[model samples]
Target: MSQKKMLRFSTGALLLLLPWFGGLVLGEISNDFSQCLDFFYNTTPPVGITAAGYQPICQRYKNQYHFASLYNRQSRSPLYSAYVLSPADGKRPRSTWMFEPQLAFSRASSEMQRFQTPLDQNVIESQAVLEDYKNSNFTKGHLNPSQHQKTVEDRKATFTLTNIVPQKAGSNSGPWNGLESEVLNRFKAFCNGSMHVITGAMPYESEPRWINNRVSVPEYMWSAYCCPSYRSDLPEFLKPFFPTYAAVGRNDRNSGEEIVPVNAKAGASVRGYDVRRMSLEALEGILKQRLGMPITLFHGQCQ
Candidate 1:
């Protein structure tokens, strides 16, 4: 064939295969979704797992005796806390932590998809029903720190379903959020690598609230610990960001009482707390049974 004819034939073939090739590439990337947390469910494997599957990075551990809350509520679920003890990567201690590595949380939005069970979506979506539970008092809490996962990709990963709970706005975005930022900043200042962090939500008091057909109630508060600190490759100017943080549940709007226990563990020369250890399978089971419905995940500020 003439050179011109050969070139034309090659172009035609490429165009013909473009759809298949493009789809394959897209699938491959989507399949690479690996960072995930698990919950418990009676079903063998919970819903919304990626094609890559879910894996456990933390161990199941709890310590109500020594644990502190970022926010406090007069709810049974408020005091209970859980964490994952991630492997120390040479920089951080192998202490019990909450939140998982590379995980982040934000309020639900249309753009993000719900990764938990189908039941979560139904339960969480009812604004009017949940309103009584939400009460405009709580903040959509996030477990992952943005400073740790600076990149958009990693930050986006934190938006998964398993990493969120309702928190008082004063607690969620205030001191508790401040702690996450300070920890990451400190890790970045003194440590040598990326900090592996785990965060969790402590449930809060529930009013007989109903929002948009959803029985909305603040179920969890905040508790986070980090390990294997961050890279010390920070500019000196940013050093101001590394101050120590204290956890306190914010004062209640209605009662005006110091509801949250700020500095809950202050002046305590304690080394660390024990963590709950569970496999990915076990976590998934819990998520399925507990969450039960699908819930949306996202990043950034949301009302």
Candidate 2:
């Protein structure tokens, strides 16, 4: 039978044996991907080497860099995830950013060697491609952080233009940042299992430029991360807020139109993409086919 037929048959059979097979499938796919940490990390061949047009949602780029995402919506914005991540260093032997992962992860693998940082300002700016803005009040923001790199050199490399967005200071450093940290902390406390987080900022019409880059990139940028395993500790006070951890801007200066607050009981959605109900395999399939690359997992351990 064809792959499609085979997949269908297997899925049906699994459904009978495993009622939660759907959840398992989704988990497997999601676990296969890593968050979109950098524009140039462990990307597959030509996709890594080529610069393609910008995609609004988490789309695929050159098959290698698949935008595995939790949500996609017309009203909200697009989000992206990475297919692979490795060391990224230009030809310069003096550069330490390329190998910074070594310091961040206690156990670094040789494959991480392929990861390189966006060294040239011109090149970094080109990849980020900041665009026009709609509401001056809103700023482009990064969902994935370069700061995840702990080492001084690795952290600095994340400052590359490719990993930036035009975001309001209040959102960037204030409530938005707090929300990310809170969610991460809560995830560790609750699930006792790893969770993947993909986030993106919705773009308006006008695109703004960052300081000193001499170029403009997306008005809003998205960042995503995954922790397939979580800690088992529990806290009663924190349980109420745990479910909505992935939601953005729980606390912010009310623009009246920009931020959306989510309720854990009712749940929330981004654009049309259901933030709570997306499978990584489905996400990967879409990205891989869209970018025209073979099946290459981007996020999590595979990254």
All candidates: CA RMSD in angstroms?
A: 16.4, 18.6
lDDT of 2 at 274: 12
Q: lDDT by residue for model 1 over 1-303, one digit each (tens)?
A: 999999999999878544323211122111221312221111112235232222332211121111111112122112222222222233322221122211221221212232322233332332111233344544444454333443343344333323334555555555555565555545544655322233443223434332223323443333323233333565876443322111323323333233332343532321111122232233334333444533212111000
lDDT of 2 by residue, 1-303 (tens): 899999999988866434222121122222222334343223221122122333322222222222333222222222343322222233212322221121122232211122333333332332332232344444445444432322334334433223334566655665556555655455545654434444544333344333333323233333333444334344665443432223433212322323333333532322211122223344344334433544323333223
Clashes of each: 56, 49
Question: Which candidate achieves the best TM-score against the true structure?
Answer: 2
The window of 10 residues in a row where model 2 has the poorest summed lDDT is 22-31
Predictions in order: lDDT: 0.32, 0.35
Candidate 1, backbone clash total: 56
Q: TM-scores of the models, in the given order?
A: 0.37, 0.38
